[model samples]
Each structure stands twice: as C-alpha cells, then as structure tokens.
Target: MSDLSATISPAVRLKGVSKTFGPIQALKPVNLDIAAGTIHALVGQNGAGKSTTLGILAGRISATTGDVEIGGARVDLGDPRRARAAGVVAIYQELTIVPALSAVANVFLGQPLSRGYLLSEGAMQSRFAELAGRLGVSIPTDAEARSLSVADQQTLEILRAIQANARIILFDEPTTALAQPEREALFKVMRDLRAEGHTLIYVSHNLDEVLGISDAITVFRNGSLIETRPTQAWTKAQLVTAMLGEEMGDIYHRRPASRLRDGEPAISVRDIALPGAIGEIGFSVRAGEILGVGGLVGSGRSSLLRALAGLEHRSSGQIEIAGREVAWPRTPRAARALGIALVPEDRKHQGLVLGMTAADNVTLPKLRAIARSGLIDNQLAAEVAADATRAFGFDPKRLFAPVGTLSGGNQQKVLLARWAFDRPKVLLVDEPTRGIDVGAKAEILDALRAFAEEGLAVIMVSSELEEICALADRVIVMSEGRQVDHIDASRAELSVHRILNSAFGVERHHHV
Candidate 1:
C-alpha cells in the first residue's frame, strides 16, 4: 500500500465545505482530503453528507460555503464542463450510455475528434483502442451499447473518462448491479487504475465491497463527517456502528416465530412461470407468515413477485386462497379483486403518483369508499391516511403533503399504507425499504412484522440477504430461473452465507 501519511499534497481537498438548499442545510461544514493515487471510500445511510460532499467535488451541485482544491491548487469545477477540464469525472449509478450508440461513438460522445470542423471517425477509433488496451478490457468496438453487459458499459464510461485525461474518477455504487464474477472484474480494473497513479473515490452502501476495494474509509452521518480510518483499522461492524450509531445486528432482528399460525396457508401457488424469467416454482404462506425470496440480481426474485401480482400477462400460475383453487389472475384488477396486492419495485414510477398528496395516494386503490354523493370526502381521506400510516411511524400531519415532497422513508411508508389500506389477504412487496436509511429500516421491517402478526399473509422479495435472514420466517432461494434451496428459520438457524450459497447454485427445492 502507498504511504497514506506521506506529505505529498492531496489530489482532492474540501476545506470547510457546506451545502444548503433554502432552509435545509443538506451538508454541514466538513474538511476532508483524499490522498493522491489511493482508493478512498465514502459511506453513509440515506440523507448523509457523503453524497453532498461528492456533489461539491463533481461540480454537479455547488457548495454553499468553502473551497475545493485539486492538486493543492484551488480550482473552479462549477459545472460538468469545468469539472472535466479539471480532470475530474464521475460515473453515476445510472449509466450514461445512449442505447443506439456504439462503444466507439460513446467513448467520444461530448468531445469528439474533428479535423477542420469535420468529424474524424478514424482518429476516434484509434484513441478508443488505445484506452481499451490501457484498461485491459475486451469489448467489441462497433457493438451497440444496449447489447453490452453492465460491466462492459462501465468500461466504456471509464474509457470516456480516460479520453478526457481524467486522473481523478468518482464511482457511485459501481457494483450494486454486478454479479459476483462481474464485481471481481470491476475490482480488478479499479486496482489497475490505482497502480497507474490514478486517484479513485468510491461511494457505495454495500459495506463488504467498500472494505475490499478501499484503502481508506470515511463515514458520514446526518450531514456531518463522522470519522475516517484506514481500511485495516475498521471492521464491518465498526463501520456500521459509526454510520448509524448502532451495531449491525441492532438494525435487524428475527421475527418471533410464535406470532405465526398453525392452520392452512392464506395463499399458495404452484407452477409460477414467466417466459425466461422464472421456472415453475411453488410456495405457501400462512395467514401470519412472512416468506422472503432471496437471490442475486437477475435470479427471478422480482419476476416471481410480479407474476403473483398479475402484472405479467404472459405468466402462467396456479393459485389457491385458503385451500380454494381459482383460475390464475391475468390482470391487476383481477388480482386485486382476489385480495392480492403488489407494492411495485419502482416506487416512484410504478407505485405511487408523485403529484398526489399522501392521503390521496393512500386512498387511491379504493377511492370510491371515501366518496359520498359523487364527491370525495377530503376530511375523511386525511383521517384515514393518518390512521393507516401511524402504524409505520409516518407523520400524520404530513398526510396532505405531496408524495414527492416526502423523504424516501416516508414515500415507502405511503406505498405500503396505500396498498394495505383495504387490508389485502396477501401483500407482495418488491425490495421493501430499498433506498431507505438504516435508521428507518427497522421501523419498516417491524411494521411488516406487525402486519403479519395481524393475520395478514406477506410475501417479500429483497436482494439483501441479511434482510431475508432477519425478516423472513421462511426463505426460498432462487438461482437463474429455478428454485435452489428452502429454509425454515423456525426449525433451523438462518445465515446470509447459506442463502448466498444456494443463490449462487445449489438447486434444491421444497414443496409448497
């Protein structure tokens, strides 16, 4: 490892930096320095100042007060162009690839080679080849970006940064969507970059990945810089405690098995299949049970949830409610009529109406129930929303506030409360509490448990194995499109490793 304490000037520096929007000071004053040619990491829960600090450095958002320095010299990276000019580039979570463009064209997108105001395609291809060679990555030069894998697209972004002569690069959640092998490939590229004397700043919520790639880690919380330590000096447990002021285990607790029921399952399904998504699979859940589905990124976890919700028209399945067989639900309306509700994956797009108020969103499913004389009762709607969301710790006074104005935590609460407003028999949630802070996570999980205790059968899908191990009374692991392993926490101990092993490929199934 390079000498972190060496007296050389830092490649990036933020001195007394702070950012605010109106009355909200999103980031408090922070002083941070990233040493030259080292992998530095920034970690925090949602609303933490880590993202704000990155924004100031990236020139995406200006800092309210303070100075930024590059190479010991003050520089004005006030916008994307200026930041690029200063040799700073950011690869956001959302890949910037244009689907129709080829790999060669994407590398030279904004700043392309031109000879006397005429595009120089030959020169661009030559430069692209050189950068690809430097990075030791093999991607078809003329391949359409949309056809490439996520890892290949990221390599194209890296080539773009290198074309701009960027010596400092920021990666935002770089490996969240990558599978195990793909993640290792990206890590190798990052290590190569560090060896070539480039400075890298990585931001991620996955603590294990953070520890593996970072030379040093900095923790941020509630708009303040909490602490910074060398990688070896910090444990995963320590990092969690610093980030949330609580141990990792404290944020998650196993649901008590005693709250479950002994009678027949509230809902059971057989032969769930959706084209190339999920293979024929089946499971059952009692009235007071939470069954979690765990798998890797494309392991059909969300697909299964969608199939059950009647969102996939091409999907075929056999479903039974309280041991009564019924025809498969092929439409959302049909599913709802049968007492099955789905809280979709993209809460902003597929789930809630952002322009609507919280109370308005909550009563959306059964709006007619709140109507009288051909007019909706605003007072009744507000009262109903307040009562529904109170169980999830949402502020009742904000019921009239627009859903867009609420935090991620509150928005999730709205989605859950809205779907469960009329009390469905089975609630299918995709990535419950995703993008929510660690602080709000427990409350959301507990609320789901409380609902299960109320005799509501819940089927949850989460990519995070720790959540599956903690919140699910039973877990069914999926690999590719097939069921791999089944575990009953009530009968056996559950661990993240066991779930991951099955997800990676063990191919064992337990009948419904």
Candidate 2:
C-alpha cells in the first residue's frame, strides 16, 4: 500500500487526474485523497503543480482526464459554484475580495441572505460580527474591505468559505502577507475548525507552519506526487529534500557583506508625507546597497514603496537620485524615465497584465526601447524577452504562454526580468519572495544581489524578517507609518530582534 493509503480514509479523492496546457503537462496522472476533518497540507516548490491541482479541485479549471469524488460520490465540478455547492471552497493567494465593498458585503458577496426577496443586510452584519469575534478579529462589518489590512482581508475570505458551509477548504498560501500575531490567530482558527470537523487543505511554502498544522503532508514535484506522509513521520530535512528533489543545507545562506567605501547616496528621501495615514518618513540608500523596510501589515510599508515608485501622491517630500533633487513623478512613465522601477506586492493585479503573453509582459515597460518611429519592433521585443528569460532561468518554451499560465515564482521572475532590462537606477521591490518556495526564494534573492552589485539602489519591503536578515545591507523598521529604527547588516542579530520588538511594542528587546 502507498504511504498515504495507510493513514486515513479518503474524504475527497482524485483518480488518474491529468491536466495539460499546450505542451506542459501540469499534472501527470495525479492521485490525491484528502481525508475528512483533518488539516491536509499540500507542499512543493514552484511549478510543482500544487496550485494547478487546487484549481482543478476548486473547479476553476477542468482536468484533461480524471474522476473527482467527494465522500465516494462522483462529482462534476464544472464551475466554482458547483464546487461550493458540493462543499468545496478555496481562499486563493491572490485575494478575490472586492476592495470597494464592505466586509459584510464581501462575506456574503455572491450568496447573500434574503428575506422574502430582499437582501438581509442586518442579518449579514450580525453574522459577520459574530464570526469575526469568534476568530478573535474585530474588523468592522460596515467598513470597506479595502480599508482593512491584508490579515483582515484574508480572515474575511476564510470566513466566507466557512459561511458557505464548505466541508473542504483549500487555502492557497493564505498567510503570505500576514503578521506574526495574525498568523498565530489563523493557526488557532484552523485548529478550532479542525476540532469542529472541517477538512482543510493547507498550501504554503512555510514548512514549519505546514508541519505544525497538518495531520498528513503531501509533497509534489514537477507535476508528480513524491511522498505523502503523516506529519509525525517527516523531518524538515527529508521533507525539504522531497519537495526540491535535492538536499538543501541552509535555505537562507546569507553571504558575508562585501567591502564598501561609501560616500555617495544612491537614493535619498526627506520629509515624505502622504494624506490620511503616512506621516513624516525619511530614508536613503547607497549604490549597491539593499535597504529592507520591515513592519506589520497596514503599517505603511506598501505606501512607502508606492510613494518611492511615484504611484502614491506624496504630500511633501524631497527625493534625490545620485545627489540631484527631483520632483516625484506622477506617472509610472515619468518614474521609469528617472530610472526608478517598482515591483508592486500584489503581483496578480499590480505586477503583470495577466491576459498578455509572457514575452509581451516582459517587454511592456521597455516597449519604446524596442520600438522605432511609433511602431513596435516585434522581433526586437521577443529578443529582449528571450534574453531575460534565459538569464532568469525562466523556461523559454513558455515564452509564448500567457503570463497567468506561469507559477508564482515564474511570474515573479518575469516581473523582475521586465524591470531588470529597464535598467532602473533605483529598484523598489515589495514582498519580492512572498508565497514562493525555498529554492525560488534563494534564486530571487541572488538575482536581487546581482542587481545591487551592478550599482542599482535596491529597496525591499517584506514582512518575512528572515528574508530581510538574509539579503539586506541595512534594515529599517516601521511602526504605525513612522520609521522607528535603522540597523546595519553587521548588526542583523541586534536589528532583527529590535525591529520585531518594536513591531510588537515589546519592552524586552533582544537583538539576534
């Protein structure tokens, strides 16, 4: 018997599930059975077909050939509505929460309560509030979801799933942007849900979280199931090896700081303030330096990056590039012209034009560079994209594929490649490695280091403290939209703990 077959009965089963996109066999005769009322974790490196499997299960996409059974009954999951009706719900990494809508409204977005044909807003509000309270969250039901933090948004998404009476909930890297406390709360909620007999298929790159929360762990590699073992039977090292099909000694692998003789600032900011929330903020970056911005969700990390990218309306601030003070550019074009580029955190919505091909997406910002006399040079554009793809180790065969067709890490790589060729003087990257696997994270950081080595001022914003500690030459901590502290890489031990302590307002701060 297979290792997975010995553990639990199948609550949801997939038999000979194979999904193909053109030449790419995303899933190859995959067999999966998620046991009922248990937290089952699906883990793998990028492009390992984890999301594709979830998409199929969620009915976002159909399998080429397979049978999906829920409780031993054959299911034709033709659409998401069908999946939901069949007690399946998914909280995707790229959130589906409507920004303009209220929390209650989003919770009951499609399946609103109705009394005699009228929407029961009051009932929805009361139920939402109750759910929120139970989840240890206090987000106002009437407040716009856009105004809520990422953690709140994620909670709302999960609540929606619960409200829909889903027996099997699939979480696609749900806590990628959540703060520590919020993540702890989520883990608690998951534990509570498990006690209440709900099956959860937790997908995440954070191995520790997966191992801690899951009963059974399944590893996928290159569209195939490698090993599906009980949580108790797996070691972190063994699991890491199975996921990557290779041993990884240290995922972080922080290199020694290179020699520096710093006299000039590559980028500088002074008296930066924005309307509503962002208060006085100031910082600077030297050439070949990585500056990390650390803060809890909604603490203005994204806002600061946006302000630097010229996307946000900066109320009062002076930005200087290589000692020359300049006005903040209102348009992205202007920012690009001044040699500044941004990799926005929300990749699906902000980073890539999903409908376009990978080549088209990569060459988007540099269209003019590859164009002549108001006419786009297709050959030149393809060449540029091809070169970038090769350099980034992105599959060239997938070049003609749509940007949406790629995995999270590949999509992120495409985003980086686009900006790399732009040759921006200063690179403002937010959440550069969010939701991607360990190997991909290492590669992305390496690429960033290379970029910095070429003398580009790189400013990165990440909630992951370890990533900051690994890649940053200097780290800045923010709390409530204000810069609280800055530390050099040599003092990472001191800086990381101090930053976290500041983030939590802990008095007993320990550096390291």
Candidate 3:
C-alpha cells in the first residue's frame, strides 16, 4: 500500500517552498508530495512550521520561495480565491458556521442558488440534502447552525466543502473540542472521503489520533522537515524524538528546586465538586510547593481548577488558607478576596483583552494599586508591570505592544505577569506552556518555578506527562472526576509512566 501511494500521482506537491516573517524563518525550504486519496498527517512541536506550510498550500500565506502543484498544475501560492477554485479548502478548529444562519444557508453561504436575482430556495435545500446524503451524514437543512452540536456543525462544514467540489481538504486540530463518539464519527467521515478519492492533510498534536487516522505521517522540527514515514512505521516515542531531533537534549527544560520542599500548608481543599464536570476532589499544597494534576481529557483535571477559581457556580468545597478555615468562594471576586487567583486555560477569551497593551492586561487585576483617585497612573502601572516580569524573561519593550500582536509565548507571559500585581497566595495554571515554542516553554517553566520560589502554592494541570514530571513536586492523578493515585517526587517514583498508569486507573510500577 505504501509503494502504491508513490505510483499514483500526488494530489499536492511542494518543491523548495519556505516562509519567512520579517527576519524569522518560519519554514525552511522543503520538498514533499501528498498523494491523492490518502490521509496525510503533519506533526511537530508548537512553532515547528506545520501551520505555515498549510497556510502556503491554502493560499493564505505567500511562500518566500519555490513552487506548489495541485494535481500536476502549478498554483499562484498566495491567493485564497485561486486556492478555492483549485479545489483546496481549509477547515480550522474555529468553525466558520454563522450561528443565525440555517444549515443549508451556511453550506451555500456566499454562493446561493439564484434565477435572475430571485432566490431558488428549493434548489439550495435540494443541494444541501444531496451533499449530506453523499457524505453518508444527515443535518437538518432548516435548522440554525448554532442549535446543532459541535460534531454536527463540523459535519456541516465538510458538507460545505463538498458542495464546493473541494478535492483537497485541510483539517487543523479538528478533534480538540470533540467527545469520543464525535471523534469516531468524524474519523469515519474522513475514511469515507478517502474512499471517494478526496485528499486530506491533517494537523494535530494528538499523536493517538494522528496514528489512527493517517496513512502517512511527517515530522517537522525548528522550521525543517525531520522525516516522513508510513503511519505503521512510527511509535509515539519515536515521533517525539523525531520532532525534537537527534541529540537535542538542549531543547528540554525542567528544573524543580530542592527548596520547594517541606513548606507550611498554604491552601487545602476537601471534597471539591462541580456538577457534571468534576466529582469530589481534595488536596493540600504547601506555600512554596508546586502540585500537578494529571489526567486524560474529560478526566476532570480542568474542572477541578475551575472549581478552585470559583468559576463553576455549582462547585462545592471546603477550603482553608494558611491553616485557617476560609469560606468557600462563590465567585471569582470572592476567590480573589480569599487570595486565590486562577490563570484560566483559554487565554484569549478568558485571560486577556487582546486589543489592550500587554502592560494594560498585566495591570488589569490590580488597577486600584496603579491608579490615582480619579484616573489610572499609566507610568506607575508600566513601571510595576515592567519590574515584576523581568524574572520571567519577558521584555519591557513588548509591554507597550498590543497582546494580540505578540507571539503565543509572550501572550502567556503577559497572562502570568498579571497575577504579580495582586499577589495571590494560591495560583492556578492550566496548560502553562501550551502552543509556544521550546525557548518560550523553558521561560514559562522557569517563571513557574520562580513563582514557587516566591512562596506561592501553585496547582498546575498539564496534559503533557513530561511537563508533569518536570515541574511537579508531587502529582495527583485523576480519572473520571476522581483522584485515583498520588505520587510524591520525594519517593523517587514520580515518573511519567507511574503517573500515566494512575491516570488510566492501572497499578503504578516500581522503577528499577
């Protein structure tokens, strides 16, 4: 089957293509071919140029050099209209469905049926039904897109592409918000598409999904293509190694301090529960300690943090601070009054105002401290934000820049720095190094360690197991909204394997 792919003409090919933004090379020159009727996956660490390559192919980005061919025809690489006309379509994580529009209207959004400027409603509905039937899926044509489930909405997007006669479809992290059954359904759809001869380019961080759905997998590292191999020829560990490159230990970052041990209890919770999200969760952490919550997606790790932050209204818990009983906080302001601060998972929507300057975002939590009687003292705010973030390796110059323009790493730095002004005793971080490059990951991890060094009890939730092992002094593994096991690093058994076993509700193995 692998050899057969080579003989069949490639549906898409890149020859010596590269991308650069200002002085930074986002993608190095690369030559590759994506065969027709195959699910090809592109995987790498964050900022490894997979998205850049996809942008060039989708005509959203102009390549700095080289040529792109779609079905043996050279393409004008930076025009979206040309890409669409050439049968190339990109389905992003953020769906393009208009909430108020009916399903059929969304499918034929800009290109509706018409007869001499008169709407042909019957024709549009029939085409919607036809496309849905051809995909072996069903979505009510008259129903509003907002009323549909996320899975159904995604299926609607695919139907839209199919309606446009898209021969090549690109999916970027399609299953990030999907449940197990929805993911399975989407996979079935992809398989069906392949069977009908549509080429797919799948980009994801989820190795399991990539392994299961792809015929071929390609690894990218530091703007370069590392390797491309059949899905059957790779293991998760091998994929990780390839993404990091051989002899690339220098990129790894983790240093848990010895002084973070044996501190007094800073925050203690008993029976924390969020309805439908997390079961009863209870734990304690010292003032200078970092405790990690490890779990699979939907295992209640994030819900636990949300409950602690007082974002979950139905969450009920008994909490104490500094060995003193404190009333359980019901709102975020109440949590702040209790000296608890949560740096939420969705930074764009929940954490920062993207249009605001980084300095403004950082000082937002404690405007009172930086403001005079009537108006804000801008100088004081800037000075405070600048001084407090140096230890985190954030630049003072970027503080004046709008947070939206900053890279993911810098935006995260701004988010973390916001907590400094208010100075919480307990800090909650969700996916601290998510969507950032290796250099920035190290800076973020170091900032976290710095926070611990400053005597703040930090509770972190990380999907990546290695991150848990690196920065966590202790780990509490959760599965299905309940704590399954606890492993302290002091016991010399807090490895990724033991934690993973506990997350899966298996017995922890003793390391030899």
Candidate 4:
C-alpha cells in the first residue's frame, strides 16, 4: 500500500441523513463515513437516493433530518457556497456548463478573477492551462462549451472542481458517455487526486468499473444503505444481488439458435459515408436479426446508426430498405416514411418530450392513426397509449403522468413503445439500455428481441459488450470513424476481448 492509504482519516460523515420530497421519501435515515485519500464507490439503480445523498453533501439540497460534517467540522448542508468553502464539490452526469461561454469562463464561473471591476482573463487562462497539464488533459480554453464533446465537457467539470481545491469530490455517473480509453484517462487523474490526499465518492451503475477502481464499496437500494465493505471482499454477483434485492440468474436472454439465421436481408447500406465522421461503411441486417454496433466514444458507431436512420446527411453511398435504394440527405420524416424509426442515444432530449404525458408521447409520431376529420381523437389516442403501455409492460396508471416523472427504465420503454407502435421494418436503436437498471435492461432487451423475432430488422449500438454479445447475431466493430472488423457472435471464440481488439484496431492471433 502507498503512504497515502497507510494513514486514513474520516473526510466526510453523515449522521441520520434522510430526505423526503412531499409524499415520497427519497432517502431513509442513513449514516456514512467517507475516508480521505481514497476512492469510495456508491452503487445503486436509478432513483436509489444516490443523487440525494450527493445533493446533501454538495449543499444543493437540505437534508430532511440529520447532520453532515466535512473535515471533522459541521457545515451547512443547504448552501452550495458553504459546501464549496468547505472544499466539497459534485460533478454530475448532466453537465452544468454554460454552453455560450468559453471553457475558461466556465472554469471560473461564479468565482471570476477580477482586478477592480476588470476581469483578469490572462491570469485565469494561465491557471487553467497549468491545471489541464497537471490533469493530463488537453482542452481549448477559448472554445465554446457547446462545441465540445460530452467527454470534454466532463473534463471541464473536473477542472472546475479541482480549481476550487475540492477536498471531497463527488462523481455521479461521470463515465456514462466516456469511451474505454477516456475512462482509463479519467481514472488516472482520479488516482493522482487520491495520491494528493483528496477524497472521491464515485457513484455509478457499472459494477465492473466500481470493482476495478474503488477501495471501498457502498451499496444502496430503495433509499437505504445495504452494505459498505472493501471492494476486495465482494464479488460481482454479491453486488448485483445487493443492488436489486434479488439474485438475477441471467440478466440477458439469448434467442434460440434456429431463429438466428432465419430472415432475408431487410436493410442494406452499401459504402455509405458521412462527412468527416464515418468512412465507407457497408453492412446488411436481415428482417429477423439484431446487428450490434460496438466501438469507443467518437468511433462513429452512433454516426453510422444516425446515417442509417436518415438523421444524418450521407455524403456518398446508398441505403436500401426492403431492397429499394433511398435518396441522399434523407430526412427523419423521409426515414419514417421509408419504414424506419430511430430511438436515439440521448433519450431525454432526442427520444421523448419530458413535459409531455406518456400517452401524448406515444401517439406523437402517429397522430393520424388516432385522428378524426383531421382532428386528434382523444379517446382513440388514450386507447392507443394504454395498449402500448401494456404491450411494453409499463404501468397504465402512469400513462397520464409526465414522461419525465417515470423511472429511467420506464422512460426508455416509452421510447421503444413509440417506435414499436408503427412496427417499422427497420429499427435503429442507440444505447437502448444506457443508464437503466439490470431488470429494466432485461425487459428492454427482451422487447428488442421480440421485435426482431417478429421480422423487424434491429440495429443496436451499445457500450456494454455483454449486451452486444448476448443479443446480437453479428457485431460490427468500428474505430476512428470507420468499420474495422466484423465478428460472428455465434462463433465459439466470440468474446469482449475479440470485440475490443477489433475496436482498437489490434491484430488478433488465432490458432488455425
């Protein structure tokens, strides 16, 4: 063990911490002690009160009842300024960056360096450069936050927290959008911070990641702390059981071998290329097949899906649905008209309207089916929504509730239901199960398989290799905006190692 781990001290302590929002108790009274100079992991499903605990520590929300102590001193748990003063900061998955501002401006937001009413841009830029170098990340300080990638925005968030000299940094699902290489880089930075005697609270749903990076592991379920122990003392199965409150025999359900190779080609892309994003990509998916796209962040997997869905304008090549070539610059409406539907990766922004009711969202794409004399028939729409709710195993009672009010898994089901309603010939789904729990993941995968089994060609892009291996009949590995290799999932040698090797352009040696 390093010297930093040899001398450990309590950095943040919560006594009887609990929170309630009106009729719902988001968190139960809990106690926790985060150690200094160590990476402590908090694992739970969505809505498991992990966010609430972080909120209280960051002073973003007041605890309903309990006390919070930072660095051995009691601090105000409701004032963000007080929390910052006490060196506590939170980096959430949903970035808090100002899009219109420059990276440097965002780094010093709310705490600008000024000299008598005049801002000191040069000083801030110098400091930011130094910090960026120290963290081993390169980011343009002058560029607008909107122009940066999700990974860059997250890097900026960390830079801001480090600039504040945060003693206890709370990270909530920070790597949800990051690729394997980028995640490794972030972990390096985190280790450096730990070596410098800073405390880290990592909250995530990725069990493998928690196991790899955490010194101590804490599991939360239904707003209650289930267990907190050293990572070495727990197995992945134990963690999953603790998180879900039950043993998940097999989270993934593989289709029958007979069904794997049944249908004819339904969607074909011949040498399709997207400007500056994807190179010539050619593939075909049968009517009853799931083609999984796998790659690191910025590897063009998402772009390829978007291109096929007609969400992106292709510079060249051809897309054929049902053996008919589609025109270039295919718009989304055109794609829908051509019997294609896209369930985008960012479901919150692209897939559904948060403010709209679940019923309204379900019927938004096919309002004509529920219309009378060019006017929407409310009764018909409600029936359609109710049918979709039951079809997707969603609660009919929540049909009238805002789509955002539902859980992450339910929201995802709503998106899938919307596209499945039309019964499109080709379904383009990106990150279908991202940010959802194990149970929800199973439900979503089952639904997709059902769709494919019913002769709907499904193209799925997932960061989870296990998902790809289990659900896909074939996998296409992409890297640096091009298709690198393809793997047959039915092969005995199919593994994450083989997929990753193709993803990173590594040459694999196979015994003949």
Q: In candidate 1, residue 173 scores what lDDT?
A: 77
- What lDDT does candidate 3 reach at residue 427? 97
Give each model a TM-score: 0.88, 0.90, 0.75, 0.87
Sorting all predicted structures by TM-score, with the top scorer first, yields 2, 1, 4, 3
Off by over 4 Å in 2: 1-8, 98-149, 258-260, 372-374, 490-495, 502-512
Name the top TM-score candidate: 2
**Weakest ten-residue segment in model 2 by summed lDDT:** 503-512
* Candidate 4 colliding pairs: none
Weakest 10 consecutive residues, lDDT, candidate 1? 503-512
For model 3, residues 217-283, the per-residue Cα lDDT tens digits are: 9888878988888899999778877876752353335555548466558998888888787765778
Candidate maximizing lDDT: 1
How does model 4 fare in lDDT?
0.83
Model 4 RMSD, rounded to 1 decimal: 4.1
lDDT of 2 by residue, 1-512 (tens): 13355455777898988899988999988887778789999999898988888998899999999899997899988899999999999988779999999999999988898899899888898888887777667788889999998888888998898899898999998888776777898899898888878999989999999988899988989998787888999988889899888898665667556444274887888877878657777878888888888878888888888877778755558888889998877667777778889998889899899999999999997688999899999888888999986767788888889998888899999999997777888999999888888878877888888888888888999877877887788777777887776677775453567668877677333322
| C-alpha lDDT of residue 409 in model 2 | 90
Q: Candidate 2's error at 339, in angstroms? A: 1.1
**Distance from true position, residue 357, model 1, in Å?**
6.0
lDDT pick, better of 2 and 4 = 2
**Model 2: colliding residue pairs:** 493-512
**Model 4 segments more than 4 A misplaced:** 1-9, 59-62, 72-74, 79-82, 99-102, 133-152, 258-262, 314-316, 325-329, 370-383, 390-400, 405-407, 490-494, 507-512
> How far does residue 50 in candidate 1 sit from its true spot (Å)?
1.4
